[model samples]
Target chain A: MTTLTHPKYGAIWFTLVVLLGISLLGPLTGSTAFVLLLAFGIAVVKAGMVAAWFMHLAVERRLIWFLMITALALMAVLFFGVAPDVMRDQGQNWGALAAGKN
Target chain B: MIDLLLKNASRSGVEIDKLFDLITFLVGFWFLLAEAVLFGLVFRFHRSRSPRALYVSGEEKHQKRWIAVPHVLVLLCDVVIIAGTMLVWSHVKQQLPPADAVVRIGSQQWAWVFTLPGPDGVFDTPDDIARVNELHVRSGAVYHFELTAQDVIHCFSVPAFRLKQDAVPGRLIKGWFAALEPGRYDIQCAEMCGIGHGLMAASLYVEEKEQHARWLQENAAPPRELVAFRFPNP
Candidate 1:
């Protein structure tokens, strides 16, 4: 990977500037849901840029790519495994005790 | 001394202390043994002044069965540990508390606000008492806790209870714990939130059920005057 002064750095800076501008104004003028989605999208782009350019993960060999892909697949499975439990209703005391039901 | 960060013999916060101790001892011993073996081999088989070095393990079958067996054992232990911990974690997260007591905990930058539900089923009402930092709970009863954060992310951790959950901004996190003993416990902020993160702490006050009720009744009385009392101008 080249140094920060490379031409690619300018593109990165421009993208960051656009993201910053949108981040600053989007939440103030838009719904929270929209702002969250926009933030998440920008974060994905930023992470991809950092990994490919700065981390040099893009230039790795095929074996390293295979290992990375396997790790990502495992992470996806783990995330899906936990998503259901995390979304489940934990405990209800107030709702029950309020009705004199419990 | 080896278990410097370990809890005492008594059970309080989380009941997984024994399991944790066993796992810690096993893992710690294995690492020390492995490192010792590696260093011993390196030093014993060093090519000092001798020009020729032994090339005994060129053939796969010539490798020591002891080393190969230990390697397989380590791999098996790794898989077993991961599977076992995953099962325990899932079990802990899935189990629901009895539908009796519930407390609302609001975690801000430097303190925790604990709100107990009143007769009206709402928290922090005129009839309910708001406790800062310290939470009073009854022993042997399962208390369902609802967690909320005022600022950034912070984790509610009770080392004795072996229970922890993260409080996120704009989102509510929930976790439950039932303690066997009625004693004071430390509430730690496990997440590295910000500068004052370390200072953000709370105390858990567990008392007998009747005493807890009396304390609640004494502290939670409604304010005497709802309307302003003023003298009429003559």
Candidate 2:
């Protein structure tokens, strides 16, 4: 019955807390893109930590590994499916507005 | 039955109504079948003498209902529903409006500013009136609003018009709506701003093209003269 009280996990959680605090304050009056990218990167790191420790995938059975891999593949497919939407303009040309030249 | 089902199935918003109906149907169908089996087992396998409960580990090929047929059917139905939703979403997103007019919408502190290109294809002009909490548009016309916020991030939403757009500081997002009928719509702030978020509301008036123009002209005051007249050094 091992609990989630490990020092390494504590460090990771602390880092996540700090990152979240910074994210809350950064986007308010400072750079928005920096805050967004940092927040997203922190999320990726946190997800990795959760998968490695909380789920205990490192010592799990082979079938569980197969299921995790399949899920990841499906997620990848979904990501690619919606990639065009986030990347594509889809609307009017907002380049001039973005460039502060409008 | 067909008429009733058709009437029940015809509601807007997302496709939640039909999905709920389908889910209810599937769950009810399964519950009835399971209940019948459970009742039959209770009646047939009644204990007349000292009888023990059978312990059956369903691991073998014959014992295990591998790839449960009903579960597979449910998964297939979910996939079909998701695919159908995706198809509808794609169609709605790709359909470009024929007469879409771009309008600039700005949110600053507790006020809303709507800028319209005053027949000259230019936004900043004397004719442009900065209204605090009102937006006027013509009915049956696709109006695209470019949303931008000054202080904090705010969301411009009108539920009746099915419109929602985020106004981020230093960035311009967009939202569009086409009113089928002429009426007054409530424009509410969907995002949590500062203390005045609850009070952040505006009015959207959808009228005929001619009526909209006439209303703008009547409500807006004439622009002041640039040169100031003064009597100095007398």
Docking quality (DockQ) of candidate 1: 0.04
- Error in Å for residue B128 of model 2: 2.0
Give the DockQ (2 decimals) of all models: 0.04, 0.06
lDDT of 1 at A11: 85
What lDDT score goes with residue B48 in model 2? Answer: 59
Q: With candidate 1 superimposed using the best TM-score fit, by how many Å does residue B105's alpha carbon deviate from the native?
A: 0.8
List the pairs of residues colliding in candidate 1. Answer: B13-B160, B13-B161, B14-B160, B14-B161, B14-B162
Q: What is the C-alpha lDDT profile of model 1 across B37-68, one tens digit per residue? A: 99887887677744578777635754777678
Q: Is the docking of candidate 1 incorrect, acceptable, medium or high quality?
A: incorrect
TM-scores, all models, native as reference: 0.61, 0.53
Q: lDDT by residue for model 2 over A24-50, one digit each (tens)?
A: 676776777887887787777777777
Fnat of candidate 1 is 0.00
Clashes of 1: 5
Best by DockQ: 2
